[model samples]
Target chain A: MHMIQSVGIIGCGALGRNLFHNLKPLEGLTVECFCRSIEKDDSLYQSSVRKIEELFHCDLILIAVSDQDIIEVGQILNAYSGIVAHCSGATPLHNFNGKGGVFYPLQSFSRSVIRSFKEIPLFIEGDNEETTIQLYSFAQRLSNQVEQLSSEKRQKLHLAAVVSQNFSNHLIALTQAYLEKEGISFQALIPLLEEGLGNALYQNAREIQSGPARRKDTKTLDAHLSLLKEEKRLLPLYEQLSESIKTYYEEDF
Target chain B: MHMIQSVGIIGCGALGRNLFHNLKPLEGLTVECFCRSIEKDDSLYQSSVRKIEELFHCDLILIAVSDQDIIEVGQILNAYSGIVAHCSGATPLHNFNGKGGVFYPLQSFSRSVIRSFKEIPLFIEGDNEETTIQLYSFAQRLSNQVEQLSSEKRQKLHLAAVVSQNFSNHLIALTQAYLEKEGISFQALIPLLEEGLGNALYQNAREIQSGPARRKDTKTLDAHLSLLKEEKRLLPLYEQLSESIKTYYEEDF
Candidate 1:
């Protein structure tokens, strides 16, 4: 059996809370944290008097803080010889100066809902071979789909995620804004929304692309544009994105 | 017990295929289609005939085609007076001239893969009171979640869907293209992709938004943009989307 005894988590924000909560239930692992606000509980094994010194004892120190604070935390944790990892999608392991690694759970986590880590893919990146093996083994315990990824690869993945999740969510929000402006209930689009997401799973997105823009049906595009003429902000977005889509499917039409 | 004898599918594409296959095994419903291609199996009761007169015989005609094609199909089917409907997201039932309704399944359909319609929501719409009732009854048999939507409302919903699914998919494609150019496999982003989609189900996306753009962390954003500096096409997308995200979180930040 693989032994992963003590884990220290820095920053008890959303990601930290999730990790701590989830990791607490696992056997043969004890979790500690160095939070600005410390709570009295037996579950939390240790609290750091000084953040840098906290890394000396634990087998793994997870820095679940903001990107801006990662380097600072890394510099502080550099003194210790333990496996220091951060849970960020974009930041590279090299930011830790060969002392730490990345233990990125490629999921959007929240405090209210419990996410299933079993099938969730964990992207691991390490500075050295020993740390890589250790991190991969740790990830394997939590998920079946764990892999070693380079910083460049991880960065690319992060950019893709921004498109898939963040930007996509913004689109939904924009749609909601448009509907609300038109006195339409957001609930009306639920079915169509579901279908759109569902369709992409089975078909290549390039093949399934549709709309006035894809067809280059100038008439329909003009009509849609005309309908949104009153909304100045949305008009430019509609026009730009439509042009992009038209350019994408220019050969098809 | 509800009696369903035969289902008439207008478009023999992905959505049509799904409906045809799912309704095939139902107790009393036999599926038939009026497709443009004769390549589809005749044994499955699919016909290549385009004329509406030939298809007017069925008890339920489900139009599963493009928005632009809906009016043309609806105009022809309006003469037959059978329970006419289309499986379009944004098109209105009034387009069917009270002779038809909508059997809009709120799930994405791909002909290559079989999916369960049980969990998928179905949005029903009609021109008249009786047709709406009938459409609702029909939708209830296949799906657990069914809603009555108006044409105007459905149109708004469709617009929102464009934002959520279509635009989001485009972002994914763009990200894939960008990464592939850098010799990165787009497959690496699947975990993040799945997580992003899965997260939307439980939480409001606005609350969970993360990224250098969302954070207004110029250092990281600049670093990301610097990497994409050579790619002329992606730079604008990266900048515009980053601006949009920043604009969205302006109040909170």
Candidate 2:
């Protein structure tokens, strides 16, 4: 038997809840969530504990709290001899002192939807070589794709993630806002959204960039800018991004 | 039998090539592309005609050129009495002076990849009721999702498309650049990207937003801001967008 049979979660936010939900069904693994307030209904898991000492008995304690609470949680778990890990993309593993590692699933998690982890990549980082291998093995159980990423690399990945996920999502929100303003349903843009994402998956995005900006069709671009007369704040972003696209295409082509 | 048995596209660019490639293999439709330059071994149907009158025999003509040339193309097509259209999301159908309509496929297109129009929505606008129905019926033959949108609505849809497609793509490119600079493959972020997008498909995007800004994790956000030390230009964009996300989540929540 391994040392890490039972897993304890430090927080119960979106990531923590998802981990609890997913880990509870796995065979040979018992899941426990450590929250400030213990809920009466323990149907989702084996148990919910209020004290850290109660969770200290578990062999693996995964900290899924906010980044602000990572150091505090780490200090609390200092006495425990089990493997400790967190699910943050930006924070380094060293923040968690002894036998610490990371179980960062490189995907967005929400309490409402359960994402399949079959092919999703999980990036693992550890304090030492042994801990790295252990966490890598554990992550492999949940996902086929696993990698050992350094703190530096993980930070960069997080930056990229913010751009792709957060920024892209903001763009979608902007699109929704624009359509809503004209009494048009946002559903009209779904096909374009799927195709844009699909194109990025199959081909190099730099090669496939289009629109008036890429082609440097100033006439159409100017027309578009003119249409956004009321949206004065977005005008600068439009011009700057268009200029960037034009420069990128020019440099490449 | 109907007068239009074949569709001819002018300007074999991304839009033109995609239309030709997709419309060619249909059971009853034969497709041809008019190229400005002559190539020796073009596999698909090609035409090198300088005059629109040379290709006047075809009943359906699709001009997929830049917006600047749209009016010129419309004038050229005014001589013929067949159904003429442009595949532009932004250009209004009235620009064609009642002689043409818009067959705007509301999806991103590329020359290298094969895209299925079956699920992609086509937003059609026309000068008359007959043309609108004809365009809708034609689009239905290729895709199941077809909607009649007014010029104003289509423009709004186009703006949303810019946010969903162009701006979203730019975000992905920025992410790729960030990861590549740190010697990390952007491929690691693909799973995350897929999950984020997939979640938005089933759930409201406003509900599932996460990250440092949404969580109000000042530590993580500060750390991310610090990482942009060298690239000062992106700082404002980062800050503005983060604020936007924070504002959105607060308002929605």
Give interface RMSD, per candidate: 2.7, 1.9
lDDT of 2 by residue, B1-253 (tens): 2535777788877787777777887887767667777466764434445555766777678888877788787787766777788888778785454547788888766667767788888888778877777777888887888888888777767766765677667667766666666789888777778778766644577666777788887877888888887864456667777877777665542
Tens-place lDDT digits, model 1, residues B21-105: 7877777676677776646455444434556577776777888887678877777765676688888765556546555777777
lDDT of 2 by residue, A1-253 (tens): 3645789998877688878877877889888888766556745434788688888888789999877778788888767888899888888876455688888888776667676677778999888888888888878778888999988778878877886788777666666666667788877676667767866755677666767787777776777788787874456567766776776665543
Superposed Cα RMSD, model 1: 4.6
Best by TM-score: 2
How many clashes (backbone N, Cα, C below 3 Å) per candidate? 3, 0
- For every candidate, how close is chain A to the native chain A in TM-score? 0.91, 0.93
TM-score for predicted model 1 compared with the true structure: 0.79
Model 1 lDDT at residue B219: 80
TM-score of each: 0.79, 0.88
